[model samples]
Target: WSLGLKGERRDLAPVSTSYYRVQAPVSTYHHRVQAPVSTYHYRVQAPVSTSYYRVQAPVSTYHYRVQAPVSTYHYRVQAPVSTYHYRVQAPVSTYHYRVQAPVSTYHYRVQAPVSTYHNRVQAPLSTYHYRVQAPLSTYHYRVQAPLSTYHYRVQAPVSTYHYRVQAPVSTYHYRVQGPVSTYHYRVQGPVSTYHYRVQGPVSTYHYRVQGPVSTYHRVQAPVSTYHRVQGPVSTYHRVQGPVSTYHRVQGPVSTYHRVQGPVSTYHRVQGPVSTYHRVQGPVSTYHRVQGPVSTYHRVQGPVSTYHRVQGPVSTYHRVQGPVSTYHRVQVPVSTYHRVQGPVSTYHRVQALVSTYHRVQAPVSTYHRVQAPVSTYHRVQAPVSTYHRVQAPVSTYHRVQAPVSTYHRVQAPVSTYHRVKLRVDK
Candidate 1:
């Protein structure tokens, strides 16, 4: 709460916004909250405990989440916060998914059940700094929603782009919600989708939903990624809409970010004609209708997402869209409040990934939002740490503005640190 912003540069435009005491430090977020306006408040006061506390309030309501590091912090809420606890009704058994997660200390794999204490649904980020998680799926698996799969389109204002989602799930469950090393959890609803199109509004941030499910609908508007991925000097092609295939992003081509369902074998079918049900199941047929881009499931099925992107460290750079396009430089330097708690009194922001990539985080270091429609994150880590967070309920300036819009702490979850959250979806 001391360092306001050394040489930090920012370009945020809060329209008709008034804030109060929002404190979230850029480095070391030992947050502390007195009493929020919410119904319940969670505290982590244990001196030496590292458990992931999770809570989901009614949608559209005032939802402020905080997830802090666990190392002898001090307080408990009876809710399981350690040893990886899933706060859901349906007990999971053998939740399998092929993922490689090792966040410096813990390595997760949704390949099995959460039976053991150490093994939670975590995925492994590859060499450079690329990893995927099924919405809840730790890695590579389809991280989907139960009924509806929503994907929020990132809107760029100034140079800093913001991805927001206002998802409204009818009746769902927190299949796999907790903190770990990697990420992979699928939202299985349908079988493998024929034309895999990523719909921003519907939140199709799926990873690997058991069977072929989601359709990557082509978003007419080219949604620019706000990630400072300004380092792809390789064959970093402009991957626009759901049509253009990401050819050389060898790092971790999330082209199929929301590949919901356990789509069996993605056959390499040709063009013009489309085989709707490219599945090994019911054998449903797809008309191969007149859609924007060809079917992602077939056109470039199997080896989808990342193209030939292998060792291009600066590859993400070239991928930042023509620099002048957005002229976004003060992107990652976003300054936010850091709520420092006293000894043995830690505050847990539901914004998991506090330790995302523990050591080798992407260009960004901290910040991880919870994508509502199931999908977890796209940008994943942050440039450094806490940027757009909120302070405790101190002042009342949030006055008329929906408290959720104050800042990080407010719509925060939606706010960044690589806020991979579909907050307003």
Candidate 2:
């Protein structure tokens, strides 16, 4: 039996017969016998005395509960998409390109290499593959140094197009030289088609054309065409025929003569027989006879005529008597008598006295005389009777002498005297 505890192991057995037999005092027997079993029965139910014992237990209290600490969380999410763009720099040379974006917003910045270079960026030029942005679309562009002093602006309205830009030009001056002196010219636009012409004397001129220009150079002058010269002159001569005949003669025969002055005579022979004669100067003289025996005679001066007869058959005659003798006598017989001149006497007679007497003076003078033929006595008288004497006797008789004596002496003496005178004188 064990003490009856609240939680103890106990054994129980059936109560046997011998039990109650021994009553042992509380300490009686010294020997401890470990009974394997004991059964006890008690009839008195009474309370027993108790002693104090210690006990340990888990405790239950009201404690506060803590949850996971609350913290602010942030999440990163992407915003709605937008487009940004930049422009490529354009070159001064010819340009080409392809576009990267269709609806992109583009911005532009200009940076020129030199101050003279310009950046035309407001309107981007169109290229083959890309178009310039509209309105205020921008680009980054640049330019190099320029060639000339003149400045130029980029034309607007950026088209989807491409073209070449020509260089700028300036005016220059030149002078003419040598023979071709003057020149004239005028200003022109960029493309000059016509040339200006110059005329007149030598002088300087200014000319310009439309375009860029270089320095002035010389050109050749135009050539001139000229005509040749000629010389001096004269004329020609002419002639006529051969007609008429000509002859040369002695003296002046006016057959032919040169042209004569006033009053000049031209003597010509007419027919076969005529004679032509010429005097000095313009006068000519000629004498011509026309009869059975035609003759042409020319007398130079004056002439006279006379005639004479030597013997008489007693025909008629004419006499140019001498200054001293004057007589007219005719006889029927032949006779002779003496005629006295200043110193001489001549004798003449003729038989045919019935005709008148005649005498011819061969030069200047003539003389003729006649003698008495018979003797007879004179009776009536206041007259004288003359006595005839012989040849030598010188005798004179008066009228008073006797007639008978005169007859006797005159007869004999006259007869003998005539015979004797004829013989002796």
Candidate 3:
């Protein structure tokens, strides 16, 4: 084994001994020697037996010895053989340290040995002589002793702490710290004081107060908030103008002038021929005009000339003296006179011859002839003639005319012979 006495340390080196043992005390110190100071890191090769040696000032040691399940190293403050004998036994295969200091107005802390698999702790103060042992299966603790005051805190995975004391000017406070699933604290003080503090799974519980608490207050959780905004916009408009007008036209057109005077001709001696023209109006029409005529006759007349001629004839007259002849003239009183004489006497042959002679006057006439003429004759001329001639002859002629002249004469004769001659040339 080795020993190190330094004012400050940076690292700890391992000191190994396999079965090397010793029978006396190992002492290593560093001091100013004019005043009291501390000692550090004294290691031993074996256990010691001496008890009466003294260091003239207070001492402090820090030692660590680690190995397997047989022996362990610890820091212990053993009193001098003249005061008391100390026997400390520790678990094997773990490292432990013990330190003790003299009476002074300073802070003192002690921690119990921790086992490797399951760590159990016992903490005691010098004057209070209170010893606590709890199975804090893998936990850590700190023990503190001040002048006339003591405090300790235990942090275990699943454990409890019950601390009770009856002192007027002394206070004991213990904390049992672990995961909140299985950790609780209970403290009982002098005057019927009991308090329990638990955390997790039940955040709020009830408590009974025998007396008034000096200060009581509570805190609350937090709250949240939000905000909103907006964006852009638009607009529109309309416009317009005015109105107008127009004109139209239609079909065909024609024009005519006025005409006057006489424009036509008639024979070679031209008559006054009036001029003709068409006159126009909304509906009617017009034209021109003329006159009438005459005649003549003729008449005719005719006149004729007539001529007459005369012829001579002779007759014998019986003029015998009336008395001589009458004597025997049985001349037949002819049947003409119807005489009744005896017929026998008349037959006496009286032959008598009578001759008659007649003389006629001579007539001489001169005739004047007249004829008619026409100036304008449309007819022919007509002429008529009448002629009558009578002479005693044996031939007789009869003429019947439209103009006739009649004459009568009486004559009686018994027998006569007469010759008449008539010539018509």
Candidate 4:
């Protein structure tokens, strides 16, 4: 602690040898209270020392305690100083409240019984004029309702889509059903026609014939031949003969009476027979001589005859004329004539010699009175003829009737159906 003295004092000189006794004490006082006020006090005691000190308070009072010494040094001299402090402390009390609610439930109710009885008593007054007005409180709530229009509209859109899909399926089913039966029937018809179309074969035949003829002829004819002949007649003769005659009767020629021989016959019928009685006398009455007789009647000449009669009577020469007789002569006949073929001669005889020389004539013989005849003969033959001929032929044929058969078969058919669905909401 330091104290400043206001009164004059004297310093002691270095050479003075006197002992100085300085006693310094300083005291500082700090006071603080609950009122948050601070007070400070300083007190000094001299011989005089230097001192420094401070005090502070922010919200409330505080007590600060210090115990320390002051030190001073001069030219090697050291001084020791003393410090003092005084504190005044006032008692202070502080209060603080803190409350926190817990996780449990709590309820508090308070009712006074006097009020309850008074309230029950008022309810028993039925005829009492009681005007009660309750405040009009309206509560408005907003409720959202699900409308059927939205669901119906959704169903409508789905229905149109379903139709779009079903259209193609229905069309396809119709196409499948339309021509199936017709096509099968057409195919069966063509098959039947083919089955009925069968074929047959051809045919052939032949024949022939023939004929012939002939002829003949005839003829007639006549023929004849005849011939005749006549024989030739001619006469021829030559004769040589003798003829004699005697005549003259002598009277009473020769009577001889003397004869003795027998006389056979004598007859004198008439005439005067003079009997000559001179029988023996020579008779000389008369005698005559004649020539020799000629055989042919043609006398050429007389023959001389000499007779010897010697008696001559009256000498008378009786001369007789030549007497002649006629005689017929025979003639020779010839007959031989014949002719053949076509030759003929006709003869006419006025005077014919009627003599036939042969009994049976030759090819031509005849009497002496007619001409010869001729004969002829003729002959003929028969005839014949012939010819040739030909003829024609023919043929025919027939064909068999056609035959056929038919048959049919069925084909497989298929059907299809589409699936459909309906929804109700």
lDDT of 3 at 86: 18
lDDT of 2: 0.17
The CA lDDT at 225 in model 2 is: 15
| Model 3 pairs in collision | 75-97, 75-98, 315-356, 316-355, 316-356, 317-355, 317-356, 392-420
Tens digit of lDDT per residue, candidate 2, span 1-425?
44345765333432211212222211112122222212222221221111111101111111111111111111110111111111112211112222112111211111111112122222222222112111111111111111111112222222223111111111112111101111111101111111111011111112211112111111111111111101101111010111111111112211111111111111111111111111111111121111111112111111111111111111111111111111111111111212211111121211111111111211112223221112222222121222222222221222221222122122121111121211111
lDDT of 2 at 317: 17
Most accurate candidate by lDDT: 1
Off by over 4 Å in 3: 1-20, 23-33, 40-141, 144-425
Please give the lDDT score at residue 213 for candidate 4.
7
Worst 10 residues of 2 by lDDT: 231-240
Candidate 3 lDDT tens digits, 267-314: 110111111111111111111101000001000111111121111111
lDDT of 1 at 32: 35
Report each candidate's C-alpha RMSD, comma-separated, in the order given: 27.8, 95.8, 99.9, 99.9
Sorted on lDDT, best first, the list reads 1, 2, 3, 4
Which of the predicted structures, 1 or 3, would earn the higher lDDT when compared with the native?
1
**TM-score-based ranking:** 1, 3, 2, 4
Query: What's the count of clashing pairs in each model shown?
Result: 125, 15, 8, 20
Residue 111, model 1: lDDT of: 23
| Residue lDDT tens for model 1, 1-425 | 11115753331321121112222211122223223222111231221122322212111111112222111111222222223322311111221122122111121222222221212212111111112111111122211212222222211110111122111101111222221122112212111211122221221222222322223322222122222111111111111112212111101111112222111112222211111111111111111111111112222221122111111111111111111111112112111111111101112122222221111111222212221111112222222233322211111111221112111232223222433322221
Candidate 4 runs further than 4 Å off: 1-240, 245-298, 316-425
Better model by TM-score: candidate 1 vs candidate 4: 1
